[model samples]
Structures are given as C-alpha cells and as structure tokens.
Target: MGSPSDPARHLLDLARSRPPTLGDGRLVCIDGPAGSGKTTLAASLAALAGAPVVHMDDLYDGWDGLPRVTDQLDGLLLPLTEGAAGSYRRYDWVLQEYVEAVTVAPAPLLVLEGVGAGSLAHAARCTVLAWVEAPDALRLQRGLTRDGPQVEQHWRRWMRAEAEHFADQRTRDRADVIVDGTAAAPPRSPGRVT
Candidate 1:
C-alpha cells in the first residue's frame, strides 16, 4: 500500500469513491498555471489509475487560443458524455495550424491536464478537480528554461492570459485538491519505482 500522504494515491482513492460524472467514466481534471507541475501530477495519477490523458496543449489552436478552448473542449468531451468516441482537431505548433483529429474512446477513467482543463462548463462533469501551483518567479523560470529565452515575450503574454482565465474561472477556489508544485517529494526507498 502507498503511504497515506501520497498525493497520487489520495487522488486515486477519491476518484474511486466518487460516482462517475462523465458517462460511465471518471474525469480527473488537472489545471493550473504553466510550469506549475500539473503535467507531472497528471502523469502520476494516470499511471496509477491506468488512465489515458488528453493534454489541453493539444486542444489549443495557438498561444492566444486559451480564450477559445471551451469550444474545443466541447468537441472532445460532449461525445464522451454520451458514451461515444470523442475527437478533437490537434493544433500543430510547428505548422501553426490544426492537423488531424484525435479520437478518445470512452473509458473507466480519463485525465485532462493543462490550463483550462477545469473550465466552468466542464466542472460538473469532473470527478475531481486538482489545482497545482508554484511561485510566480519559479514558474516563470521553469517556463523560460524549458521553452528557451527566445520565447520570453510569449511566456509573459501567456502568463497574463492564464492569470486572467484563472481569475475569471475561479479555478483555484473551486479546486477539490490544491497541490504545492514546489513541494519536495518524499524520499523513496531504493529500487522503488515511482
């Protein structure tokens, strides 16, 4: 058994205890600012639950696409709610255009991770909403390091956009669980797989 304080374990337990809100499946929505470790937490939860994750990044049309994500999410999630396969046009960052459609079949569990994953329109359908966060400076540093300094302007713009979205959505206030993205992980025993 995992430790009582293990966030992934706790999240899994909560999900299992809840009634399915998305068709016959539970939807775990992980939303937070960029570089806030939302992706890492989603990966951990998905691995533990043997769930497939749909990244919001793939649903976004572009850097300025955050404001328009509800329509994209509707395309992806509405079908799933009816026990049908859902599909969304993936935005190709390099091509700067939407590419082929990605289909997601209904399952026992599905993880939606990234900004706008827990928008108001979809909140009622989420089994659990988790908000992960780190300090602004740390998040900015991480973003710059991963995306390169050349995209600093883009990062700044994105930061403002996400802040506005989060504020408008009251995402943090509605979160069922709030994780400290900067928290140090507990020490693991030798040879233990995370």
Candidate 2:
C-alpha cells in the first residue's frame, strides 16, 4: 500500500480489499480514546466500503463499561464470520440500561467504531484492526464539545476508563494501521462494493 496521506481513504481501501492478513469475512475495528476520531474515520471508511457500523458507545453499559462491552461486541460479530446475522442490544446512556436489540444483516465488511471496539477480548477475531489516536488535550476538548455540558462529569469518568482499558489492552502496538485522526482526509469518490 502506498503511504496514504489521507488516513481515512487508506483505511477505506483496506476495508474494500479485505486483505488476506485478515481471516474470513471482514471484522474491522476502529478503536481509540473518546474523541480520538474513531467515529469519523469509521464513517468515512464505512461510506467507502458500503459497510454497516457498530458503535461501542451503543453497547456500553455506562461510563465504566469499557471492559464489559468487548464480550458483547464479540458475540454480535462472531456469528457473522460464520454466515449469520449479527444482533445485540443497545444500551441507552440516559436510561442507564439496554433498550433495544439491533439486527445487522451479514455483509462482506463490518465496521466497529469507538473506544474499546478493539479490546483484547475480541481483537483476535477481527479481520483488520485500526487504531486512531490524537493528543489527549485535543481529544478531551473534542469530547467535551461533542458531548456538551451534560457529559462533562461523565467524560472525566470515561477518560479514566479509556486509560485503564488501553493500558490493559496495549491496543496501539498491535494495530495493523495507526491513523493520525487529527489530519483531514483528502477527497476521493467512494467505490463501495457489496
């Protein structure tokens, strides 16, 4: 692969190709701390790959749910590798509980985006794992801005969970691609394939 200045397009190419380094069907994980740009990258890649995405925030039980959500992510995705529809319950943060079970039809490529999406519990099963990281200060500001005043306290708590989870998982060292989330993606027409 050429050194792609646009990290998102590069990742989109990776997803479209389904590189052999990955096992069977695509299980791509975009992981990083909150506001590290995992969501943005995932969206760009998903658009290019014509893939459905699973956001870890929807699976999280709460601010301290980082470690707990990996199992659920694994359960939701593992079935797809064997040609079954993936399903899971979405946890509502405001309600502080799981609300609905979402069904994701099996596809050639599946994207999981958010903090802890690449946790060790299921990283081995992923076809491709991408780590998007940004400066802590910038990430914190992005998070606070996105989440707004309501989540200021929750953001602090999630920050602690992010540190502990990343430390335990050693996610960066193991990633197949390291993306500088701060950089803007160059424009490219999406050639998504089913």
Candidate 3:
C-alpha cells in the first residue's frame, strides 16, 4: 500500500487494475461523519481525474429535508452514471423553498460526497466506495464550530441521528478506502495527549 498523500492516484489505480471483485461504471463515493473532509477529498480526486462531482450538499434540504435527498440523488446524480445531463431541484434554505434546477453532464468519473454517500441505499450503483473516518470527539467539535451557537440544538440532534445511522448502516466498515482526518500533528506518542 502507498502513503496517504495522493488519494486520487490511489483510487484511480485501484479502479483501473482492480480484480473482478469490483464492478464497472466509474462512480466513487466518499462518505463519513460530518466534517470528516469528504467534500475536500472528493474535489481533489475529481480534479485529479478530470471528472465532475455531484455534491450531496446541493441535494439536501437542510435539517428537515433529508427524506427528500434520496429522490434528488436518484433524479439528479444517478443520470450522470450513463453520461446524461443531471438535473434536480435544489431547496433554498434561507427562503425555505424549492429553488432552481441545476444541471451537470456526466463524465468518466464522478465523486459523490456526503453522509450516506456510500450507504447500501446508494451502493448498488457505485463502483467504488471510500469512507473518511475521524474520531467522534474531533468530528463533533468541528461540526459544532462550523454550525455555530445559533444552531446548537440542531447540531446536537443531528449528531445523535448520525451516530445511530452509522451504527445501523456500517458505512465505514464497508468502505473500500478509509481516510484518516485527524489534525495534522505528528503521530502522538503512546502516552501523550494533545
């Protein structure tokens, strides 16, 4: 195995030379707990492959809109699997309305990023599934900071739900690649804290 510096190269090589265990169609999913940097990694991978990404954030309808996400993913992102124009209705969080129609054309590789990006619910169509795993304490701190105090209650509830979802779904365990998203400090000494 190689080092973690170039994930896209790693994935591409895996896709190209993989044995018959993995299937075809070039779709990769990067899933994880919130704030695990799935989006950042997916963007990097997409750029490396000269592929486009189908961001799940664009499909979500905020805290109350999750149930509708699967529909959007099916309608918008999945079409790209066949090199079609992907189109879906996006929800406007601020105005609290279903906003505009966004369209994207499929490519050789497509990076799907977000929670449940690799869930069994979505995996039947994915060629590769990658999970970015981070410690819960670290992830919660990052998510809380990003979400801010105004949405403290919302964040807390979402975190609980996410925990439950991961437990039931086993998304990380089923991943083809596991990414470590801890802070960029040297590997901690066995007995040290920081």
Candidate 4:
C-alpha cells in the first residue's frame, strides 16, 4: 500500500488508498468556509467514489447553529461508522425548523462537506480528511454571491460561530490534506498549513 502521488486524477483515489483497519473504511471530509469550493470538491470526489454526500448546511439548526450541528453530526455519524444505518433531521432554513429525519444507509465511503464536517471527533474516525481554505475577501465575496444579498447579516453571525468552532475543534490542524480553494483550477498538489 503506497500513498497517492498525484492529486490530479481524484481525491477519492488518494483517500481510498489509506485505511484504518476496515477494508471499506473511508470517510472523506471537505471542511472549509462558505464559498470555499467544498461542495464542488465533494461532488467531484463523490463522482469518483460513488459515495453519498451530506452537507452541514442541511443539518445546521440556524445561522448560529455551528456548536449544535457538531453534536448532531457526531450522533448521526457514530452509528453509521459501525456499519449501522442512521438518521438525521435536516433543518429547513426557510421554515426554520427540522422537518423530518432522513435515513442514511451504511456505505463504504461517505463524503461530508461543509464547515465543521471534519471536526475533532469526526476526523479521529476518518480515513482521509481534507481541509479547504481561501482568502477571506474571496470567501466573503463568494458567500454573498451564492447565498444572495439578504444573507449578509447572517454571514457575519455565522463567521463568528465558525471562528469559535474552528478554534476549539482544530479541524484544519488535523487534516490529512489541505486544499487551496483560491486556485483557478483544482489544486494539483495538497497544501501544508502554516
């Protein structure tokens, strides 16, 4: 078993090559700020891995739900990690409530993308974790554009929550790979955190 030397083909390839005992033990995490290209990267990896992808946005209770969301995710992923089907209620941003709990079947690889996806507890159970980052200005710009102008105020609140979560969880510090979202093209090489 050798490490993947190329980052061009697919992140899935690199991730699947690493293991933590189980043959199908792989949880690919794409954690980063809003508009940092986590969704795009997760989609690409999912295409290559044929794995199910779940977003943190759907699980968050609200704009300032980062702390709570981590607990929710931890509860959901715990059972799923041990080859058990688990369920979670997706928070409806428009309605501002959890509608129903969606059932998630056990799979070899699950792509979890969004802020706090690769949190300390989650990362400990993951086979490969990727932490994505981009310039603050670019991230804010992308968030404003993607989420619409109405969310500017919410974005500010969310940023504060994100800061607290990251500082405490140390998600980026423990990542197996660091992805630079600012690159015009998908990163050709994994990054190193300063």
Model number with the top TM-score: 1
- Kindly give the number of clashing pairs for every candidate: 0, 0, 0, 0
Model 3 deviation from the true structure expressed as Cα RMSD, one decimal place: 6.1
Clashing pairs in 1: none
Model 2 ranges off by over 4 Å: 16-24, 184-194
- TM-scores, one per candidate: 0.92, 0.86, 0.80, 0.87
Q: List RMSD in Å for every model shown.
A: 6.0, 5.3, 6.1, 3.2
Q: Write the per-residue lDDT of candidate 2 for residues 1-194, one digit (tens) a residue.
A: 33477666666566566653223467788888888888888888788777888898898888877767867876787777567777888999779999999988777777889888777777556766788878888998998788787788888888887888888888776677877778764323233211
| Whole-model lDDT values for every prediction | 0.86, 0.76, 0.67, 0.74
Model 3 regions lying over 4 Å from their true place: 1-4, 18-25, 183-194
**Candidate 1 at 56: error in angstroms?**
0.5
Ranking by lDDT: 1, 2, 4, 3
In candidate 2, residue 91 scores what lDDT?
A: 93
* Clashes, model 1: 0
Q: In model 4, how large is the Cα lDDT of residue 155?
A: 90
Quote the lDDT for 38 in model 2: 88
RMSD over all Cα atoms, model 2: 5.3
Supply the global lDDT for candidate 2. Answer: 0.76
- Residue 123 lDDT, candidate 2, scale 0-100: 59
lDDT tens per residue, model 3, 1-194? 23345666666665555432112246788888887778777887888788778777667778755545778877765566555777878777677677899886655666778886766666666666777767777777887788676877776676777677777777766777766666353211121111
